[model samples]
Target chain A: MKKTLFEKIWERHIVDTLPDGTTQLYIDRLYCHEVTSPQAFAGLRERGLKPFRPGRITCVPDHNVPTLNQDKPIEDPVSRKQVDTLEKNATDFGLAYYGLQHPRNGIVHVVGPENGLTLPGMTIVCGDSHTSTHGALGAIAFGIGTSEVEMTLATQCIMQRKPRTMRITLDGQLRAGVTAKDIALYIIARMTTGGATGYFVEYAGEAIRQATMEERLTICNLSIEMGARGGMIAPDAVTFEYLKGRAFAPRGAEWEKARVAWQNLYSDEGAVFDKEVHFCAEDIDPMVTYGTNPGMGIGIREAIPSLDSIDEAGRISFLKALDYMGFRPGEPMLGKPVDYVFLGSCTNGRIEDFRAFASIVKGRRKASGLTAWLVPGSRQVEQQIRAEGIDAILTEAGFALRQPGCSACLAMNDDKVPAGRYAVSTSNRNFEGRQGPGARTILAGPLVAAAAAVTGKITDPRTL
Target chain B: MRNTFTILTSTCVPLPLENVDTDQIIPARFLKATTREGFGDNLFRDWRYDESGHPRPGFVLNQPTYKGDILVAGKNFGSGSSREHAAWAITGYGFRAVVSSFFADIFKNNSMNNGLLPVVVSPEFLSELFASIEADAGTQLTIDLPAQTLTNQATGRSEHFDINAYKKDCLVNGLDDIDYLLANKEKIERYESLVTSYKLQVTSK
Candidate 1:
């Protein structure tokens, strides 16, 4: 039988099938961070369960670490304890941990790809929801819970019922100034966030084929937002090229063999999928989220949707979101003033995202009181941005590029939004209290954030 | 240790909206409480009440005749942030199972491990189930853990569902990750002693 990539990998990982029909599938890699891991480690301790495969589990303290200062203990005790706990758990379990002070330390999602620990033909589980970020490398990666964390720690396996497959083909050449982030936001807008429920989305077609590994990661990162088990892109020459000298990837002779196998990772032509969504890149704009939910988005030039314009069910939520955002219905999102402009998080904190922001902000001064913040997703991205002169461009533009961490994305560390402040972020989520208490977030692309930083208003980056 | 699976076929209440998020399930403001207790009262707290905190007469849960132990929500029923507080509030509110056409990756995993059954059914089957449930609030449904079947007693519709082999083992056997480890205690101790001895010998050499 011609099986999907998922079926092939899942069958390969199946250790045993329980009587209840769930497969006890073996996990190849387990990535964890501080926020959800302490409890899992405690569960392991409670049961006297040692790490089943300690070597494959990599720990990083990203969620709770302060992005501004990396030299000292975090000021918040709760955040500090979470960070310290992950360190102790990793040490106690004899697992590799890139602690807050470690040179390689960064967000679990970013570090996995940067270090090549995420690769083709692997099953990766992380406590963080953005674990789908690894799917860009052609791995089957998804988030796991603390108890599932305990299960992976004790047995190096997870129980998973199968999910239907979706093949989303977005063909055609992308427009200038449009980005992978825009494509992602556009898809989220069209899909209405739940369009691909109960399915693993396989992204294909020419646009995805041409995207950089970083860009592909951005696409896969938001699959969860659209109700997927996860989203994945098949491995190709670009993937091989990106992983060529990475830290954990196969090298030399092994690389050739791996490449040969990866070449065949694409979905077979004429293969059927449970559902298919087709998108043309020409119509996609540099997208931005105006409301709390990512799906409640409009094109950068479009006006905010109001209760009067929407259906009955959406009216309540739409008006509620508009009220919370202090945005008037039918008003244009462009030229709306911003309190902060954040260019980071796993979504847009990569080197390419930085390059995009710098490309726009070059030779321009940042808008005063905008509090422009740029956080790279990983130490490598931070270094890469500096080497590429992007950091200088940003600082000259009045945006100070901060250290790599999940900074203001969630108010875990010191980077928080003051009450009633509005922020334009490149992160995946815009949930209430995601940035801080009463801090409204509008999710957008790096270019949009750069434009927001320069204008202190939501302007179309293409125009800028 | 409550291994006797009291399989109740839940009277499904359809929350047909897509992208029902964590905030909608349990409002974020209620997260200030240090413990998971008292969250049940606030499950879908915003939707359950009017602007003045009075019960919304139209809300399904507050209806005079609706009584259910299961909730059947639309796709992305648990999308958004990974707050285990959603699960706490849900389970505390007496929902033993949440059947959905789809669930968020984090929220589904969180639900299953927190001892709440997160069941997935075909979208077509779900639409039919929703129709039946909406017809009668006194609808009694039985979810048989052993057979992996859902039976609507009122409608005489018996539907089969699929669960993961390992999660089914855990949920049905009442064995969590820690319990699974304890069950393998003998093999674990044997492996530990062997590893310890090998380490000591290498150091001595």
Candidate 2:
């Protein structure tokens, strides 16, 4: 039988299968961050175990580190302690450590690909849901819990029951203002957040192939939002080009050999998928989430669904979400005032995203009523923003660029939006208080966020 | 010792909201700990307490009339973030199992890894389970791990749930993946030697 890209990577990494039906999947790369690794390291210490392959592991402190003041100690005592724990753990384990203020220090997912640590035809695991972002290079990457983290550290292999496969083919070209983020939100809205559970998705067709590597990463990063095990697009010229000449990527003859292996990473011509779904990219619109979950989204010009549109079983929760957002069921979301704007996360924190945001706010001044936090994904992205003069344009538009970290995405640092205030965010997830305790977040693409920062409300980017 | 899960009979606390994500289970601010203890006190922290740090009497967890070892929630529970902290919070708050019509993939794995059972029932069955709890807080549900069945004592309705055979065995035996992997170290090494290496090792830029 022919095999899919996921199966190709998965089968190659299988070490063994137990009588109880669990396969031991070997992981080529394991990324760790401060928030989740401390406990795992503590477990290793208690068990008197060491990392089986320390060279394959990489660590960074991003979740709790502040986006400002790289030179000063973290003011939040608890946050500082966790960052300290990770540094100590990495040092004791002899792993590559990227502590706060290191040039490579950033969100674990962002730095992996940008630094060329993520590669095609490999199995990657991280203690973060956005680890799926690495699958854009045709790798099998997914999130695992800390117990699995300890397992990987002790053995470099994790037990798993394989998931079913899905193929989501996005055909044709996207509309003028519709972006990769919009397409992601569109798919999640259609899938209703749980539709893809128990499946590993493979994104294919013209639209997916046409997307830039950064755009592809954004698409795969949201695979978890719809409950997928992970998502991937087979490596092509775009993937190879994105990895070429990067700091950690292979050079010369080794690069040529690696490219040849990556070229065969696609699904065979007659490959079979357990399920398949199709969509036209032109059907997607600039989307904005109106309620608590990522699935509660609509086209920018649309109104929030009325009570009658919701099924009786879900109406209570639906109404509760609207109430938390301070939105009525029938209210139009377009002109709803936005008090804050956040422009960074693993999902939309790439250089392309910064370019898109700058495209909209180049000449226009930011709304005086809104407080905007424009952060880069990594120090490299920050340096690029300056080299490309994007920072000057943002400053000229009255927006300041903050240092790199996973700031405001989960509000672990001081970049939180105050309670009950509305924020137009380019980051993923709008769960209640995700941006801050009781802070209302409207999830959107970079262009939509830029539009909101200028108008101080949820404005359609196309209209602006 | 508490890792072994076999049989449980307990009443349930009903959270009739869909997409109850991990962030709501435990907010990001409280994840600064270096260890796993004391998370239960802050489970559902924002919802259980007000800005003034007082209990919200209206929340299901804070109500005196409802007390249980099970959490019966609406569909699509634990939908965001791969934080096992969410599972830690649930287990810490005294829930051995979470029942819903659906669950996110990573959360389900995390729950089972921590010996917290995730029971998936039909949509109608979950709704009825919530209704039974709302009608009377003392209603009990029995989960038989070996049989893979969940029974509602109030209505005497039963449903079969699915779990990975290996995970179920590990949970029943109070075993974990690390133990199994540690035992099979030689197999892992042999397999690694036979495979063609695709890894690009770089110590620094």
Candidate 3:
């Protein structure tokens, strides 16, 4: 049978089928962070189970660690305990742990690829929704709940009912100033939040193939927002080039063998998918989310949809979302003043994202009215910013790059947007209180975030 | 551990808002705790209470008229985040099941794993369910796990929902996946050996 890339990878990882018809899928890599892993670790302890494949697991403390003052102890008692618990669990299980202040310490998703522990033709699972970010390397990666996390820890396999496959083809040259973040927001808006539920999406066509690895990672990072089991792109020359010299990537002759093997990772010419959708790159604009969910987005220059545009069934929720966001239906988002500008998360905290932000803020000073949180995804990315002198440009623009962590994206630390404030965030989610209680988030790409930083309000990046 | 589910009957709390993400179910700041207990106190924490820690009577849970073990919500309930804490909060708050027209994939799985049933009804049926509850807060819902049926007692309307056969079995028996995988450890080891040998051949060549 002619198979799609997802099917081929799924087939390779099957250990056995449970009588319940679920596949016992072998996991090649398991990434853990402080927030979700504590319960899984506790479960293992309760069952008196040891890690089946300790070598396959990697742990880091990102979600709870403060972006600033990482050298000091975490001040919040509960947050401190969670991070301490993860370190204890990692030590107990004999797993590789990148603790706070470690050179490789960063967001689980960001550090995984940066160190090359993420490879093509593997099955990766993390206790994070953004684990789909790793699927850009052509792996069958997805988020799992804590129970599944514990299952993988005890057995190195997860029980999964194989999801149907969907192929989303975005074909055409992207407009100038448009980005992978815009492409993601564009797709989610067209196909609402639940559009891809129960399907593993494989991104294909011109736009995806031409996207850099970092861009591809950004695209895959938001797969969960569209309700996908996961999303992946076939490994190609671009993927190989990205992985060539990374720390955990294969070296020398092993690299040659791996490259040859990975070359066969794409779908067969006549492969079939459960569903197919095509999008034109020209249709997308530098996007911004106006309402609470990721799907409630519009092109930057467009107005919020009128109530008549929302179906009767969704109107109540639509109005409720608008009320929560302090937005009026049919109003333009172009000049809405914002109070904070956050430029980091697994979704957009990469070095390329920093570069994109710096490109727009090169000569412009930040708007004095709004506060800005410019955080990198990883220490490596932070180093790249300094090495490339992007830091100088940002400092000149009156912005300071903070330490790396999942800062303000979910606001687990002190980097929270104050109550009732409007924030133009480069994070994946804009849910109510996601940044902080009573905090309003307008999701956008790094470029859009940069524009908002300089103007202190929602502005079209293309115009800036 | 959650008790096994066979049949659950209870009044329903209606939240008509769409895309009720897990973040709203349990906010990120509340997730700093390492343990899963006491999450119910903070369930829908922001929505149920003000920043001053006072209950907002306008919210459904706080209203004297509405109280229930079943949560009926709008379409696409539990949309964002893979945090199982959302499921923990729902179950911890004593909700045996959540009814919606649609559900996000990870949230559904998390709910099932934690024994919180996610009942999906047709859009019209869900609308009617909401209308029935709005007309009176005393509307009752009965969910039969074995038969995979959800009945709105007030309207006498029942709908067949879908649940994975294996998952249904697990829920009925309160069985966990880890125990089953442990019993099949030999199978996993054999598969790993095969994969390792295949990789060895590629590297050597």
Q: Estimate, for each residue in A1-464, the C-alpha lDDT of model 2 and write its tens digit.
A: 79999999999998998786679999999999999888999999999999999989999888888888978999988998999888888888888988777888888889999888999998999999989999998999999988888888889999998899999999999989888999999999998878888899999999999999999999999998898999999999999999999877788988999999889999999899999999989899899999998999999999999999998988988999999999998889889999999999999998999999999999999998899998899998999999999999999999999998889999999999999999999999999999999999999999999999998988888887
Every model: iRMSD: 7.1, 1.4, 4.8
Each candidate structure's TM-score, on Cα atoms with residue i matched to residue i, is 0.84, 0.98, 0.98
Tell me which residue pairs clash in candidate 2: none
Give a tens-digit lDDT track for model 1, residues A265-366.
767766777888899989998888887788878889988775667876456667767777888888888888898988889888888898888888999999
Query: What pairs collide in candidate 3?
Result: none
The list of candidate 1 runs beyond 4 A from truth reads A18-21, A306-311, B1-18, B23-75, B82-85, B92-102, B119-173, B177-205
lDDT of all predictions, in order shown?
0.78, 0.91, 0.91
**What DockQ would you assign to candidate 3?**
0.53
Q: Give the winner by TM-score: 1 or 3.
A: 3
Assess candidate 3 and give its TM-score to the true structure: 0.98
Residue A105 of model 1: what lDDT? 78
The second chain of candidate 2 has a TM-score of 0.96
Model 1, residue pairs in steric clash: A22-B164, A22-B165, A23-B165, B9-B141, B9-B142, B9-B143
Model 2 per-residue lDDT at B35: 86
List the per-model TM-score of the A chain.
0.98, 0.99, 0.99
